[model samples]
Target: MKTFSNRLYSDYLMPSRMTTHEDLIRAAQVAGYTQTSVRDFVATLRGGRDPQHKVLIHRHDIDTDLRTARKLFDLEKKYHIQSSFYFRLSTMDIRLMREIEEYGSEASYHYEELATFAKRNKIKDRADIQRRMPEIRDEFVRNFEWIEQRLGRKLTTVASHGDFANRQLKLNNTEVLADQALRARCGIECETYDQILTDHTDIYISDRPPPQYYHPVTPIDALRRHRRIYLLTHPRQCETNWSANTKDNLHRFYEGLTW
Candidate 1:
């Protein structure tokens, strides 16, 4: 297995890192990820395209930093690529969302309603969560409605924000939207990472882990495999300087704890 140090050194030594976002562009042009947005992927499905093509869905979960999200938007625009940017309601900005949409990208909710409710209400028991399922679903509906109204369109999809800390309590945010009636009422489709795997048989690659850490399949590996790809990245992760990005993310996380 390649170590993180090895990967860091390799990235530092690579020339493609210096020019015009070459590394990512090369991943699409030469490495065969075939950069795609979630909207386009859905359209292809609706149009009944062969699902076996080397499709790559560029998915971004904008957890906190909208500034970095803008930077990423510009980068994708420069390359004539489109992607999906999922924003938490807490971080939703109408102007920024519109700007991203104008760049030919799609916007959707990154939901954590159940987990947020559990934390806010101090609900810890499994039985308590089960009993509150209806309430949780209501909260999701309210939140989805607010976002949809702000976006000025009915949302076509959503993705769950994995609440790792709440997983021990078996309180999954996605579960709140599991009721088909609730989904229909919201007029939205949910696409969690698990669903993406099940639906497309796509290989997943994420830059959430530092570049040094080994992923099950690296971007290069996924490209070589020629499989459908669901590529998730935080905009901060793609910053030109990885070390600086890490430092900023840690600082932001600390600030969030205090805020």
Candidate 2:
């Protein structure tokens, strides 16, 4: 608990190390890159077309904090830049998601069906988790169809969401898409981690583990240096308020203890 608290304190309290999503996007523009959503990015690749200009594949996994996600949506809209926002079940807000789509951005699922199944069923053994793959895939399909039905559109892409249960069982949510047969069954054309995408991406940067200290170069510097970039962010990482961060930290801490 003490270790977690200190990490949160340093991460949220140190404003000097903070870099807003705005900072990174503006930097990309200054470096002569046009931002594109994951949906468009995948389509471009599959179409056998290569962009003539520098491209920034901007994506956000809305794990929590709907308000912060909106904060990002507003910032992106202000610049007339369209990016992808992948919503987990926990952060699903159909209205805001539709608003984002109306503004020309892509909104899709950040799925964690495997991790969720393992946690809820108390299935700890790796083999047991593996044996239940079909059930997990069914849950994923159900959620995917549910979201698509509500959004009133077909979803072509999805991104796997990670969780502690994934680590404990050495299973990934992406395992649901491990077979091409299943991918075709689900009608998902692409996932964020597909090698067809990652192989083409020149650099990948994320706000996880706090990019400020984790990366040797800041995101702005990365943009200046690399031509093709995949930028992933979580809305929770954008919150800078110490009190809110501390509250979230403790909530997660106690939640983990119970788990």
Candidate 3:
């Protein structure tokens, strides 16, 4: 681990203004991202909460590194803010999931069922997978059931994991949720970044880019035009004292092969 850290630090350019735990705190204080969980956001929509009110939905996609995830959860808990965490099956830890839930945060599956199913069945052609929507929907239901049973709670929300490599085929992993019947059967509702943008007049900020390159709406811009905001961050990208670029995340993912 020391060797890997050194290599990353030496090779990759570190950003000067990374989004650390303190940055999150400052954002909350200024009402940059109102403290709200995805579940709460959906509930507000259903209950007809004032749409014009300033609200923020904090979403974390745990693509890899549970340790970093725990760190993030602790940081949010300290601030009395609740956020939603979406987990892939490969990274799912029952104990950690329950602990986060007990901390008042919403937990849901970060699903890539279609992509997983296609790979398992050796179906590389995107058209072939698209034609078998029914099968893909069934796979989604099965995974949902598995996760719910393990978590010992009914999940009302889900978000699709992006399969960027499959983008060339015009395949979106979230398409499985397009089938309303499947959603009803699985007892889950889906949220996508695109849907959030369309449903609310809010500022959308993401930590996908390196901090130096990540220039989100300034506090002034946020306050003037949009009070509601949606912030999507990956736990892998929220590390301290390290570059959270694709190469670093890939290294972490590969290192966790035994996990």
Best candidate, TM-score-wise? 2
Give the whole-model CA lDDT for all candidates, comma-separated. Answer: 0.69, 0.81, 0.71
Residue range 1-259, candidate 1, lDDT tens digits: 5666644544343232223334655676665456777767876765777567577788888876576677777777877877889998766877888877776788889998777777667777878888988988888888889887887866777888876435757766778777889878887654555464447746677664354422576666767775787777764444434554456457546634642
> Which digits, one per residue and each the tens of the lDDT, describe model 2 over residues 106-128?
99999999888887787889899
Q: Cα lDDT of model 1 overall?
A: 0.69
* Candidate 3: Cα lDDT at 2: 68
TM-score of predicted structure 2? 0.89
**Count of backbone clashes, every candidate in sequence:** 0, 0, 0
Model 3: worst 10 consecutive residues (lDDT sum): 10-19
TM-score of candidate 3 versus the correct structure, residues matched by position? 0.80
Stretches > 4 Å off in candidate 1:
1-22, 31-33, 194-197, 211-214, 240-259
Can you give the lDDT of residue 113 in candidate 2? 91
The deviation in Å at residue 81 for candidate 1 is 0.9
| Model 3 lDDT tens row, 47-91 | 777567677677888877677788778877877888898999877
After superposing all C-alphas onto the true structure, candidate 3 shows an RMSD in angstroms of 5.1
> Residue 4 CA error for candidate 3 (Å)?
16
* 2 versus 3: better TM-score goes to: 2
